[model samples]
Target: MRTVKDAWMMVQSEYRGNKLKLVWASLFSIFYMGYIAFFVGIMMNEIVQSNEGHMAVDIMLLSITPLMGFVLNRSAFKYWSEDSYTRMLVYFKSLPIPATVILCKRKIMSVIAFSINGTLCFGLIYAFSKNMRAEMDLGDYIAFTITWIGYGLIVTGLYITFELLFSGKIYLVLTLAVLIVAFGVAFLVQMGGGNLFLYTILCSQEWGLLSPLMWGTLLVGMASVQVFSKWTIHRLKSRDLL
Candidate 1:
């Protein structure tokens, strides 16, 4: 059996050897970050400046980063799914290493990727938030920043769990549909004077409500990721190559 160090090498070597993949993966994330910077940060900043009553626009801009973070997380797990036709995963399965170990490594990788993506997303928003922050208290700014990062990490874990057990089509369909429906429901909440976006909640001084839901759902979603990891290992073991 290979040592943990050997398994680490196996994974890292694949990444190091594939420079093009490394570049493509990076560009993929850069694309999303750039989109948020221009469309969300710049355009939305202008919108808020001109149309101050549109809380929904600001809220929607805040939500996209975490949703993109979720997309980044899903990409981490996609290679392991049967749909990707990626050979490294197949190679890993044939080795003597434990599947649980492999799962752990992948989870670590996902967390690192999520953190980097979260930081970039945060930085972009913070840049745009400069003028807005001038009006808000320090404590609220801190809370808002933490809440944004917390939501990004939580949403990423949720999607990683989804990718583990479901087919690509199922993952894609359910994910898009659910996010669409969530915003739809959120719109109603906005219309009814009970905004569901965290940015709105915090700005409205309703962090009491948003805090529990954010932390509570995040705790539960993280737990689900652990369960999904073990379940995915069992699935890989039982699944036939043919």
Candidate 2:
């Protein structure tokens, strides 16, 4: 219980330390998602441009939510890798909090940020778009939002694992290599030239049920957990930050 309390306090401290960045990050997320939704709303409305256009607007808006979520989550990956924060993480591990507990608190902070931005984005879309509650039921929208959050968590976890996998100057090389591989695989999947790759799985089916989005999210999350556990154990053993 005390450990949990300590973890919470640490989270509060970190949040206050980056309060300015948090404000900007929140603004950035809201504005970024708003921009995506606005363009998509325009595209849908222009194509239909009638009462019947409401369905088109709703469809496009809901469909793009996950993609917007993806963009915001990608930004967070880079943010965590920034030098000062990375050093902060090293310092954090030097503290007495349980490793898993600390990691969970960090992830919770991320989820809060993602949720704040996502909700704002959705609110902006609903307010400004023609389909404000027209095409989908509220229940469906809620489910989509939850799934979108799950997607963000999976992406964030994978990137953190990527950072932990390499060390020193080699990490820069590893970062570029990982980005290249990820994008290359994505492009190949987009071009229909890949088989059973992560991107291929993502592009394989619809967004619901046992779709690539959900399953791939689970797979990536599980993989990251395993890799992260190993990495954390090694880091604790070495007691080295860089």
- For model 2, state the Cα shift of residue 190 in Å: 5.7
lDDT of prediction 2:
0.51
Model 1, span 1-242: residue lDDT tens: 35446657755875798888778777777777756665555544554455334455545643564455432433445644545422435556677557667666666665666566665665665567555445445455445545555555555555655554555666677677757755675676667765344343354245633456456655665666676676677777665543
Ten-residue segment with the worst summed lDDT in candidate 2? 196-205
Evaluate model 2: give its TM-score: 0.58
Quote the lDDT for 168 in model 1. Answer: 62
Encode model 2's per-residue lDDT on 82-134: one tens digit a residue: 64335655766667456666655655555565667667765665455565345
Off by over 4 Å in 2: 1-3, 16-22, 40-82, 95-98, 126-128, 131-133, 163-236
TM-score of each: 0.68, 0.58
**Candidate that scores best on TM-score:** 1
Clashes of each: 0, 0
Q: Find the candidate with the highest lDDT and give its number.
A: 1
